[model samples]
Target: MYGTALPTRPALHAEWIKIRSLRGTVGALTAILVATAGIQALSAAAGTVEDGSLGEDPLFAAFFGINFGQIAAIAFGASAFAAEFHNGGLRVSLTSVPNRTRFYLSKMAVVAALALAVGLAAGLASFTAGQALGGASAPGWDTPGAGRAVVGSGLYLMVMALFAAGLTAVLRSGTLVLGLLIPLILIVSFVIGGLVGGPAQYLPDRAGQMVLRSVEHGALGPWTGLGVSALWALAALAAGWLAVRHRDA
Candidate 1:
C-alpha cells in the first residue's frame, strides 16, 4: 500500500456523493428556490406606478433572494463537513487519505463545486422567475451581461460556503462554529450598518452584494466588493488548512 498513491480526484467525488445524500442539503436548496421564486412572484404581481417605472427597481428587484439566499448557501456548504465532525467521521476520512490537507481540500472542493452549481441555478431561476413575474419584459438569459449575475452570485455563494467550512474546521464543532459565525455574518452586519452609516459599505457581506446588484453605488466597485468577500474566505480557509495540518484527528 505504501508504494501506491491515493486518488485525490476520486476522494473528492466520494465526498460529493456523501454531501448530497443528506436531507439538510435538500431542505436548504428547496428553501432557496422557494424564497427566490416567491419573492419574484410577489414583486411581479405588485401593482406598478405611472411614468413607465416599476414600484421596485429591476436590478435590486431581481435579487431579492440575496438576503435569505446566503443562509441556505452557508447551511448547504457547512452541513457535510460539520456533520462528519459532529459524528466523529473525520477520523475515518483522515485515516483513508492520511494527508490532512488533502482531506480538508477534498471536502472543500466538493462543497465549493456544489455551492457554485446551486448558486447558479438558484440565482438564474430567481432572476428569470422574478423578471417574468414582474410582467415588464425582463432580459433573457442569453442577453449580453444578463448571465453574469447568476455566475457571480454562484461564485460568491461558493466562497462563502468554503468560508463556513473553514470556520467549522477551526472551531471543530458544528454548534460552536454556527453559533459564532451566524451572528457575525447574519445579525451583526445589520446592526453595524445602521450605526456606521457610510463606512459600513465595506463589510464583506455588504460589499459582496455589489456583484449581484443592477447598479453599483459605493466606495467599492463590483470587482472590489467580490474581492473583499474573497479575502474573508481565503483568510478562513488558510486558518482551516493550518488547523487540519497541525491538529490530531
Candidate 2:
C-alpha cells in the first residue's frame, strides 16, 4: 500500500527520503562522529609536542581522528548507493524515476549533502574534544588557520564520502568499494606516502587531507589539494553516470 510512486515528488526530495529511510545511513553517520571525535580525543591525550609524535601543530593533531573517521564516511557513501544495486533496488528506483540522469544526480546530491552536514558536525566535535584533551599544546580558536582546518575537516570528509559513492556507483557493489577503498586509503596510501614521498601526495585521501594540516608540506596547497580530491570525485561520478545510463538496471 505504498502511495504514489517516488518520482511524483521532487527528485531531490524523493532521493533524500529513500536514503534517510535506510538504517545503515544513520549508523554510518553516527560512526563518523564517534570515530572522529573519540579517536582524536584519545590521540590528543596520548601524543605530545616534546616527543614530536603527532607534530607540533595543535590543529593538525586535533583533526588526527579524521584518519579513522574517513572509513565511516566511505562506508556511508558506498553502502548508501551500493545497497540500491542489490535485490532489484536500482531497477525499482529506475522504474519510479525513469530518467537515469536525474535519478543519479539527485541521489548523489543527497549523499553529498548528508555527508557534508555530518562531516561538519563531526569536525566541530573532534576539534572541541581534541583541544580539551590537548593540554598546553592546543591552539586557541582564533589561532591562524584553526578555523580553516576545522572547516576543511568537514569538506575533506564530504569529498571522500562522495568519492566512495561515485566509485560504488560504477562498481555497483558496496563490498567491492569498501574492500578497495578502505585499504587504499588506510594502508597503501600511508605506506606509499611514507616511502615514496612526493608523488603519493596526489592520492585522493592524502590530497584531501592537506587542508587539515596547519602547514602545506606538498606540491599542492591546502585548497589545491582539496581541489584534486574533488576532481577525483567528479571523474568517478562521471564514470558512474555513464555506467548507469548505458548498462541494464
Candidate 3:
C-alpha cells in the first residue's frame, strides 16, 4: 500500500531512490571528469600553458573543468528539488511527511553525498589524466604545493555543489536558483572582483580559485582558499536551513 504516513519508510526510501535515479545528478559527476580531464587535454594540445609553466605543479590547467563543470553542478542542484515541484511531487511529499523540515533535510543530505562522491572522482581523475598527457608537468609531486592543489581541486567541486544546493533550498524553485547561482558565482563574482580592484580578491569564488593552481597567487594559500570556500558553503547552507524552516514544502 502507498504509505502516506509522516516520516515513513516510503518517504526516506523514495527520496534516496529519487537521488540515485536522477540522471542529471549522476551525469553531473561524470561531467566533472570529462570537463576537467578533457579540457586539460585540449589545453595542453592548444598550448595555453608553456611546457614548464606549471613546472612540477601538477598541471594547473587541468582545472579548466572546474570552471566548465559548474554548469553540470548547477543542473544537479536545480533538479534535486525542482523535479518535485515540476511534477507536483512536492505536494505529495509534504503531505506524506507532514514535517517540511525533515523532508528538506533529507534531500540536503542526499544531494551533499552525491556531490562529494562526484567531486572526489573528478578531482582525482583530472590530476592523473592531466599529468599523463602533459608530461614533465610543472606541478609534479616534486613541487611544494602540488598535492594540496590536487586535493583542493576535488574538494572545491564538492563545496561549490553544496553551496549551490543550499542556494536551491533558499529559492525553492529550480529555475530561480539555477539562474541566480550560476550568474552570482560565475559572472557576477568575476565582475565584482574585477571592478573592486585588488581588494575583491577576498571574494569566496576568487579565494577558492587558488585551489585550482599548484601555487598560491592570491592573498590566501591553498588550504585558506578552501577555507574561504567553506565559509561560503556554511553561509549558503545556513540560509537554506532557514528557508526550510519557514517555507512550505
Candidate 4:
C-alpha cells in the first residue's frame, strides 16, 4: 500500500492544478506583472541623475517597481497556504496524503515554484520597460552588477513569497499574516531603520533590496544580504513545519 501510494511528483502536479484553479492566485500573478512593469516604466521616464548616494544605483531604478509588486507576491503566497486552513481544507489534504511533512512540503514547493515563475517574469518585464523608458540613463546588460541585480530581483521576490507562505502556515490565517507582514514591510521596517540607522540593513526587505543596488557600501553586500533574507524565510518555514506537525489539523 505504501509503495502504491501517490508519489511526490503526482502530489506536486495535483497542487499545481489546485493553484491554477484559484482565481485569486491568477489575479495576484497578473497584478505582479502589471504593477511591476507599469511602475518601473514611470520611474524610468522620470529619470534620476547619478548622485553620490544610493539613488545613483541604476539597478535600483530598473527594479524599483518591486517595492509595490512585492505586495502581490506576498498575497499570493499567503493565500495559497492559508486557504488550506479554511473549510477543513487542510484536514482533507492530510486525509489524502497522511504524512504531514510530505503534504506541507508539497504545498510549499508549489508556492515557491509559482512565485519564482511570476517573479522572474515581473523582474524581466520591469527591467525591459525601465530601460526602454530611461534610454541612456538606464543600466544596460554591460553595466557592472546589472546581471546580478536583474536576476536577484526575481530571487528577492521569490524569497519574499516563500517568507509569506511560511508565516501563513504558522499562523494558519492569511489575514493575520498579511496584517503583520504588510505593515512590517511597507512601513515599520523603514521607519525603524531610519530611526535606528545601521541595523535596518538586516531587515528582510532591506537586506533583499541590497542585491538591487548597483553601488552598495553597507555591512551586508548583495549576495550576503540575500542570504540573510533566505535565512528569514527558512526560519519561518521551520516554524511552520513544527506548527503543522504538532497542531491539530
Candidate 5:
C-alpha cells in the first residue's frame, strides 16, 4: 500500500523534528543568546576605549561576548550528532531512510541551518546590548566595520558549531569532542596563540575570530580567515562521512 520511500525531504524533516524536540538543543540555543549578550553587556558596563583598558576598537569589545557564546554553539552542534550514537538511534534512523549519505546530509543540513539562524540572532542581540550599554563610546551601527563584525560574529559561531558537529561525527562521542575541543579553543588557541606567533593564527578558532577584529594584524584578512575555518569544518565533515560510510553502524 505504501510507495518506495524517498530519503531527501522526509529525512530532512525527520532530522528537524529530532533536533527541535531535544531539550539540550533548545537549552544550547538559549545559552548562546544569554552568554553572548550577557557578557557583552558586562564588558560594555566595564568601560570603553577611552578608559585605556578595553582596547582601541570599540566594535571589537562590543562583540567580545562571542568568546563565551561560541562554547554554547559548539555544545549544540556536538550534542546533536552525539545523540544519534545513543541507544541505537542511528540504526533506527537508517532503517527508515536506508541511505547513509542522505541521512547524514539531512542531519547536517538541519544542524547548519539551525545554528546559522540562532547564531545570527545571538549576534544581533549582542551588538544591540553591547552598543547600548557602551553609550557614546560605542561604535554606531553604520560605523565602518560594525556591520561586518556583527555579521562575522554570527558566521563565526555557525562555522565553529559546524566544525564541532563534524568532529563529533568523526569521534562518535560529543563528550570526547567537547573535552578535546574546549581545551583546544580555550587554552591552546587563546593562551598559546599569543606566544606561538605566525601559523598559530590559522587555527580554526583563531582564524574564525579574525573577522571579529576591527584591526587586521595577521597574514589572512577577515573573509580569508573565516574561509580557513570553513575549510576546517568541511574537512572534518568529509572525514566523518568517510567513517560513516566504511564503518559498521
Candidate 6:
C-alpha cells in the first residue's frame, strides 16, 4: 500500500504554483474581496429597521454581499479546473503526475485553500464595512450568533467554491458547470424554493445560506444546513474522482 501511494507534497506545491501564476485566479480573488465589501457596504447603508419588525436579522444585511461574492468564488473554482481541459493541459499535467487521483486531489487542495483564504478575508471585510456603514442600525458584534454568522459566511464561500470545482472536474468543462450552476444558484433554486417549500431548503445554495442568518426558523439548523451543503460538495467530488480515475485524460 505504501509503495503504491505517492507523496503528495510536490503535487500540492506544483498546483499552488500553477494557481499563483494564473492572472485569472488573482482577478477572481480580487473580485471576491471587492464585490463582497462594496455590496455589503451599500446594503448596510440602504437597510433600515422597519417599525414593528424588531425581529429582523441584521446579520443578513451585513453579509448580503455573499450573494454576489459567491459568484466570483464559483468562477475561480471553475476556472481552476477548466484550465486543465484546455490546450491539452490535462495531458501535460498527467505526464508530470501520472496518478490521476493524486493530481486531482492536489488541484482541489489548492482550490480549497485559496477559496478559504479569500472567503475569510472577504467575510471579515464585508462584516466590518457593513457595520461601519450601518452605524447604530448594524448588528452588534456581540449579538448572540454574530460570530458564528461571520465565520460561517467564510466557510460557506469556501464550500461553494469546492462544490463548483468538483462539478467542473466531473463535467470536464467549465462552461457547462457555470451554465448549469449559475442559473441553479441565482434563479432556479430561489424560484423553486418558494414554490416547493420544505425540500427546497435542502438545495446546496439554500442549505448553505442558512449559516448567514443570525436567527434560525428554517427546518434545518445552522450547522445542519451547512452539513447538507457539504454533502452536495462531497457527492460532486466523489463523482469527479471516479471520472478522473476511469476516464481518459
* lDDT by residue (tens digit), candidate 2, 65-96: 89889999999999889878889799998887
Residues 1-249 of candidate 3: C-alpha lDDT, one tens digit per residue: 223323445556778888778777667656766776677667666666566564433345656666776666666766776767666677887777666767766676676667667766777776666666666643456666667666777677767777777777677777887787678678876566434236556666667767776654657776787788889888888898788667655
lDDT of 5 at 9: 80
- For residues 1-249, what per-residue lDDT tens digits would candidate 1 score against the true structure? 622333387788878777778888667656655665566566556734122453234464467666677777766666666777766787887777787766777888888877788777778877877666655455456544456777777787777777778888887765676676677777777676434227767666777766765555667766688888889888988898898889877
Weakest 10 consecutive residues of candidate 4 by summed lDDT: 47-56
For residue 54, what is the lDDT in candidate 2?
A: 57
In model 4, the runs with Cα more than 4 Å from the true position are: 1-7, 46-54, 192-197
RMSD in angstroms, candidate 2?
4.2
Q: Model 6 over residues 95-161: C-alpha lDDT tens digits? A: 9999888898888988888888888889899988877777776777887778888788788888988
lDDT of 4 by residue, 1-249 (tens): 544433499788877887888898778767877788778877677654233322556677678799888888888888888878889798888887888887878888988877888788888889888778777667788888888887888888889988998999898898998899899898866566434237778888888888987776478889999999999999999999899989998
Alpha carbon lDDT of residue 245, candidate 6?
Answer: 84
Q: Model 1's lDDT to the true fold?
A: 0.70
Task: Give the Cα lDDT of each candidate.
Answer: 0.70, 0.83, 0.68, 0.82, 0.83, 0.82
Model 2, runs deviating above 4 Å: 1-9, 46-51, 193-197
Clashes of 6: 0
The reply for model 6, stretches above 4 Å from the true place, is 2-7, 46-55, 192-197
- Candidate 5, residue 148: the lDDT equals 85
Stretches off by above 4 angstroms in model 3 are 1-13, 52-59, 188-199
Superior candidate under lDDT, 1 versus 3? 1
- Pairs that collide in candidate 1 are 44-133, 44-134
Better of 2 and 5 by TM-score: 5
Query: TM-scores for all candidates?
Result: 0.83, 0.91, 0.81, 0.91, 0.92, 0.92
